[model samples]
Target: MSVVGCGYLGVTHAAGMAELGHRVIGVDVDAAKIATLAGGRSPFFEPGLDELIARHLANGRLRFTTSYEEAATADVHFICVGTPQLGDGTAADMRYLDAVVETLAPYLVKECLVVGKSTVPAGTAARITSMLRVLAPAGESISVAWNPEFLCEGKAVSDTLHPDRLVLGVPDEQAEKVLREVYAPIIDAGVPVVVADLPTAEVIKTAANSFTATKISFINAIAEFCEASGADVTVVSDALGYDARIGRQFLNSGLGFGGGCLPKDIRAFQARAHELGVGQSLAFLAEVDAVNLRCRERVVEYLRKQCGGAFTGRRIAVLGAAFKGGTDDVRDSPALYVANLISQQEGEVAVYDPQAIENARRAFPNLVYERGVLEAANGADAVAVLTDWPEFGTVDPDVLGEVVRSRNIVDARHALDPARWLRAGWNYIAPGRPALQPALVGTV
Candidate 1:
């Protein structure tokens, strides 16, 4: 099997396939990424990926290449390239997907199965099918399948190795047979499979992510009511989570979803809906998008109040830069957005993350970078924990309290205990939670 486009999705999937005892070739246009993977090193940060690459490359089950010849010889190919949101933020940019198909389709000289694992708008698989039929030397004999990836960034390795379910978008029985064999090891391990037609498979990913994003925005939108009514969002979510129908997966009432997938997927889904003339059906997603963006702005607003109504020359330490914990992906990171907002307002922002410092520095060159949380907090007026990394949740509040000029903490991701920070001589502020009213900031 060949896993094309070795970014977060492809690299992990390649390593995962090799782990399941398949000879897998990792392909990418980026020479550096190919080199890094070929040498058993992951170019990006994902938990346990380096170990997987090392183990597989040692056993010769995994390899990396930039040539299309390596991919053409494989019996199955997985298209896992990025489908980023368009520049205008109106639709998904399919240029990368198109380029991959254009480059690889001509090399198909046999009956090979082309599986697409990227999160794309509905009908993308059908479009790719049309392109392959026209371009492939193998003609209409080759099969194209849609198998959208369900891997999460931080837990990507595990997610691929032990998926809850497998969804295959197949054009015919042959496509399904090819996919079943490609994933035989996983199926033997008891992972259920859901088979559907081409277009349905395409919608599954977009629809799933849209619903998850909506759940996140739903809780965030309700948390606003909690803020206005002096209610505790934690308690509200805790009770709401008791209903089996409403699980507690993305229910945390904090800075909303932002990563490579969720934000862009929801927007792309909306755009596709609009294109299909059902725009009004998923219209609430616009609010979900707005609410997600507003969470970051609200953090900025809270910081403004914490700064006594001015941001100029104020010192703020922001903890966490990746969109969420466990991965170094900074695309559309809310933490970086909030930090950039504060810095733009003339605040002295020192940002730190456990694993995302390098990527964050590259993404936001103007923001100050620090090595450790305490270093970022040093001499700052307040600290905002934005990305929900576990370390930030467990960091000693007293130590951070001593580092900052004012013991003010904004738990933007709801990742810290307000009682702990307050007891440690710090003012705890968070969205959807009561702020550090002067009455509540008295000595413990």
Candidate 2:
């Protein structure tokens, strides 16, 4: 089996396929990524990926290359390229997926099944299948299948090893049999597998992501109301969670959803719905987008309010930059959005993160980057915990309180304890919860 485009998904797929005893060749157009993987190093920070890559390297089952010909000859080719959101931020840019299909078309020898593992708008598999049939030497016989990836970044390896369900989109019976054989190891391992038509499989991925994003935005919207009405969103979500109908997965309300998958997938789904003349049906996703975008603004506002005035001349320290913790992907990161807002207001903002600083620096070169949490908080008026990293809870509030000019803390992720900051004689604030009021002047 071959995995094309060795980004996060490609690397993970390659490692897993090789672990399943298939000789895997990972193909990528990027020389740097190829070189990195060839040396048995993972290009990104995924738990267990480097070790898995090294293990596969030792077994000689996994190889990395920049050649499409090496990839095209594989019995089953998994196209795992990225389809980022279009410039307008609505449609999906299928350029990468399209290029991979075109590159692998000429070398198709027999009845090969090219499985798509990237998240794309519904009906994309059908379009690509048509294109491949026109391009490949075995045009009439070459098959395409859609098997979209459902794994989140942080838990990708585990998710792949033990997926909740597998959706295979195949056009014909022969294609289904080939894919079933390809995933036979996983099927034997007892993971739920579903085989459906190409269009339905494509829809499954977009729909699943959109639903997850909608659930997140739903709680965020409720959290806004919870803040206004003196109610706890955590409690509300907890109670709502007890009902089996509204299972608690994406219902945690904090900083809004932002990553490679959730945000872009929803927008692409909405864009596709519009293109298919169902624009009115998906209008609520526009609200979901608005709700998600609004949460970032609310964080900026909460920080400004805690600072006791304008953001023009305050030294604010921001913690965390990856969209969520555990990965270095900074695509559409909410923490960076919060930091950018503070910096744009002419405030002195210092940013720090465990793993995402380099990507954050490339995204926001104008903002000041800090080497550690202490340096980010040094001499600042307020400190905002933007991303919920595990190490963040270990940072001593008392020490940070000593360096900051104002002992005002905004825990945007609701990460740190509100009472602990107050015990340290600092004012603490969090969204969807009441802020601990500042002590009256000259009062013990």
In terms of lDDT, which candidate is strongest?
Answer: 1
lDDT minimum window of 10 residues, candidate 1: 435-444
Local accuracy of candidate 2 as per-residue lDDT tens digits, 1-444: 889989989999899888888899999999998999989899888888899999998899999999988777788899999999998768999999999988889988777788999998888888888998899998977778888888888888887777889898888888888877877888998999888998899998888888889999999998787776666777788899999999977778888989888888888888899999998888899999999999998888878876776888899999999998889999999999999988988889999999999999999998899999999999898899999789898888888887888888878787887778889987776666642432311111
Candidate 2, superposed: residue stretches over 4 Å from native: 435-444
Clashes of each: 0, 0
What is the C-alpha local distance difference test score of each model? 0.89, 0.86
Model number with the top TM-score:
1
Deviation in Å, model 2, residue 392 alpha carbon: 0.8
TM-score of each: 0.97, 0.96
